[model samples]
Target: MTPEFGSRRTAIVTGGAKRIGACFVRALAEDGWTLLIHCRESVAEAEAIAAEIGNGARVVAADLATVDGPDRVIAALEGMPPPALLVNSASLFELDSHDDFTAEAWDAHMNANARGPALLSRGFARAVPAGQGALIVNLLDAKLAQPNPDFYSYTISKMAFAGVSELMARVLAPQGIRVNAIAPSVTMVSGPQSRENFAKVHAMNALHRGVDVDDLVRALRFLVASPAITGQTIAVDGGQRFLSLPRDVQFMES
Candidate 1:
């Protein structure tokens, strides 16, 4: 983008339809940002959130698991002022242990969780003006620090993304773009997890508390306002990384 072109106070959040993604969308909106809520198939939820925020937040649709998804998301920024922030909050968290893992499932997880965010960060860096200083915050999992066999594909994909964040931070620092990540512990229910299991696992951290939407909002705000911090992952997992759980908390028997 040319220096002559000014940027908007805009942010794009992938998977901004529900869960923690939607929470970030609302938080950014409240911070006076024009939100571009990106969703794959949950367009209705995205639209609902947009309407609730009443800030003219637009919903962009793209399956990040597909080849054209990142491009499609980046294309939405065309004709509009450049976005100041890009939150790679969308992820594929399907269950596939090592014993049951398949190439198809692994590829699917990698495409959506790692490759898509990496490409989106690249596109976002290019789209930003020469010195506007943009930030890309990727959502990661705390389980990555002490990985278990549970959700093997998902864990591997996040590991790849963590590496992507570090690499991009080094390459983009001179260009005034910062790439960072946040590792959140299990805050919400996962696939097929019963309420009992969720409660039991949510407290399995050093702080005895799980990550929350407020924790994420605070972290993003700090990153957005801080100009000196880059290439670092701030763990908001309530010290979950310090513990060594043999299995993902979800699978631990009560």
Candidate 2:
């Protein structure tokens, strides 16, 4: 029998073309969701995922680093049912220290990681039916808990988004929309790292292990299925946030 679908069973995963974003998209798709996989440049990969899923999954390409990005995604909701799950997973992770801050870097990070998520959250809340329950999950870095100067601009933007997550939860709960975040550790090979270094860094956490795609999928599934888990930020980072690291985990033992 074919699966039943509804707006309340729909999801939009930003940056859902590759990497962790694509992982989220696949997870939700497997759990029987009508997907709107949003991508920026990785259109081919996004299309492939959509084609593979074959569940009315659409690929939306928009610059989540701009104000109009949310509009395009929201507009795609027309005629189709509004998404009940909006994963703010797109981000600009560039290197910038406190001493090297520049307007370009700041704007790019703020727009993509902070402003874009906030706008999309608002759009998602509005699209959901009044007093109908829905969930919005933000993908944040575990480093936000252990603040650092490395990736300064990216850190600041994520910090801003963290604030938005809680505040939006409080503000949107009246509409029955839940807002939460998942802060994951060094889950993937990011930035500049040799295979050896990546492996070493991955196990530096308290659990001597790294968070993985399945771990995040579990957290997201919990938030989506739970009826009373709002304003919460779940760290699936093997206790990385509990440590007092002065720099990013990758640079800690280097």
Candidate 3:
């Protein structure tokens, strides 16, 4: 059934053209949210998603790494009713060990994961109307909790963004805007060794499992509607965060 525009809410979810972001968009679409889906390069996928959602849904292309990109996205919704929600789901995850990390790599990580969301949150608060109170959900990672030595820059960047989530929550609350986050452990995506990594990561979870995208979508919906909850980072990590491994143990021995 085509969603009713009048009853529909609207949300702008960055990096929402595919994967976990797409899952959230689908859930929100089903819940009657007309989406402003954002992507940096996935135009075809974004269009496909727009077609699928079909409830006055639209797509915007914005590079989170550029200053102009955030402004362009915010401008696209100008004079329209303020979106009821914003999901800063766009991010860059790259593996850079400390010794090999370049200035370019560090800037990319900080800009995409940390600065982009902060800029968007600033825009959302400044633009969204009061009494209508907007919700913002930033998709963080469980890697922030247990820093991966290999993925150094990505983990550090997310850790900074996670802190920004809390700051936004406290500062935005006075304006009736709620900001929160969901940190996921292992989201099954693909590559040659992806399945092996997925299995290893899934086993790290106390539940001995990995979560499907649907699980994250559920968490997003709850946070969106839950006015009382803000500034918190919920670990949708299948209890993986609680598993304390012995750091001193050598990987070769294990």
Q: Score residue 179 of candidate 3 by CA lDDT.
A: 88
Predicted structure with the largest lDDT when compared to the true one: 1
Task: Indicate the worst ten consecutive residues by lDDT in candidate 1.
Answer: 1-10
RMSD of each: 2.8, 2.4, 3.6
TM-score for predicted model 1 compared with the true structure: 0.94
- Show pairs that collide, candidate 1: none
CA deviation > 4 Å runs, candidate 2? 1-8
- Model 3, position 202: C-alpha lDDT score: 55
Ranking by TM-score: 2, 1, 3
Model 1 Cα lDDT, one tens digit per residue, 1-254:
12322334678999999999999999888877788899999999999999999766788999988888888988888765568789999999988898999999999999999898888888888888776778889999888888888999999999999999899999998988888888888878987789989987887888887677899888988888777889988888888778888988888864
Worst 10 residues of 3 by lDDT: 245-254
Per-residue lDDT over 175-246 for candidate 2, one digit per residue giving the tens place of the 0 to 100 score: 777889999988888877667788878877788887888899899888877777889999988988778788
Q: After superposition, how far is residue 93 of candidate 1 from its true place, in Å?
A: 0.5
lDDT of 1: 0.85
Estimate TM-scores for all models. 0.94, 0.94, 0.90
